[model samples]
Target: MSAPASPQELRKLIAASSWTGPTAGVLDGYQQANLAVVPRDLAFDFLLYCNRNPKPCPVVAVTDPGDPVIRLGRTEADLRTTLPRYRVWQRGELVAEPTDITAYWRDDSVGFLLGCSHTWEGPLRTAGVPVPHAADSMAPPVYVTDRPTHPAGRLSGPLVVSMRALPGHLVARAVEVTARYPTGHGAPVHIGDPAGLGIADLSTPDFGPPPRLEPGTVPMFWACGVTPQLVLPNSGAEYVITHYAGHMFIFDHHVDETP
Candidate 1:
């Protein structure tokens, strides 16, 4: 199928299950977000968690308790059906990956739209820094790191980062380009040495496929939206919800704009 031309159209396609895969590189100029829905009882702690760890869990739009439609930059996007895929968690364990969570939806569930690095791909490309995953039509590789997030009430765990192998020269341009977009996990957290982050092998990512790197390219790591997913197995929340590995929600806001 041809690509949906606008965020609303892409959302509609996702709602209808016509697109049930990673949302990377779609709706190029608009912002794509990682979804995190937790019971209202655990909302404050999670919100605090995002606030304390802005780099990895940057907040974009958050739905009020029980409200499915997002009202940040746009008012029409619904959390229940807007994302391509969703993951349901129980006692810190992921139990389901579904197209829609209407069956699990609760009136007290709060949805969070966290900033995603995919939102920075356009700027990177504009700066002459190639976005490898976008060029390959794949999701960037995400991995769990030894770096720990500050504990906020009930949530705390290792940081997760998405890896991008950059040409040695463009690494600086990539950093400069992404730094302007703070809400989208601005700049590189680590430019080389995956071992520094406790990542043993780039080939065995915790989520998504291993990256394809050229001979002279060096891996650069950026704070990833997958941080919450990594935290889930350790957070004590009775229930949690998130987007499946590479699946994300598209929002009407542009990358430079705060939602």
Candidate 2:
């Protein structure tokens, strides 16, 4: 249908398969979420993983085992259908990328909603920072770094980061603005050269497209929610589902509502 006016409207559009694209730069005042659903057996391990790597896997809302709803008691949003797209992983390999995961939903599944960097892109724009991926259709480049997060149980993977190029003067201001939203990855983990993080090339991201940079603008990296997707493959889980990179779940509440 027409463009969604609010977060709830965007979610409705996504659920109905009307808007199945990157969720960044939409519903500016509301928060966006990265979704991870794993088996009940591995739930504790994933919970511990999130606790250990709070920057990339900051836990916002988690659903009870087998529940498809977000369980914040705010709305009837169904986890199986709210996000624009989902990645279904089985036996360490991705099996499907669907607009909705109705057939994939299981009774033993648990949904964990992690904070997304897209949540703070709105605030950054409000603060006059130029974010190149400000369009809803744009997805920022993500790279797997040499820095490894503290392992918890069976989950251990190199840190994955999303990149944004900013002018020299605006980098510090961008950090200052985003640091207020800890749940949304806080601030830049590394700035300038990507090689410091073991990234061989900025153009060859492990996920999403290449970086959008102008002359005099340097690349700044932020801890990414996609880190969980990388961790889950080696976690020995039989089945896992997550939102497609950059296609986040739109939350009705604002970022301040998160703890």
Q: Each candidate's lDDT (Cα)?
A: 0.85, 0.87
Candidate 1's TM-score reads 0.93
| Decoy 2 TM-score against native | 0.93
Return the TM-score for each candidate structure.
0.93, 0.93
Q: Write the per-residue lDDT of candidate 1 for residues 1-259, one digit (tens) a residue.
A: 6799888888889888898877777778788888899989889988999999999998888898998888875647778988888889988787999999988889999999888888888888887888877876787888989899898887888888889997788888888999988777999899898999999999899888877777999999999887887775567777888988668888887887765
lDDT of 2 by residue, 1-259 (tens): 4668887788888877889887767777677788999999999999999999999998888998998988564655899999999999998899999999999999999999998888898888889997776764677888999999989888999999999998899999999998998779998899999889999999889888887568999899999987888899778799999998778887778876742
Rate residue 201 of model 1 by lDDT: 93
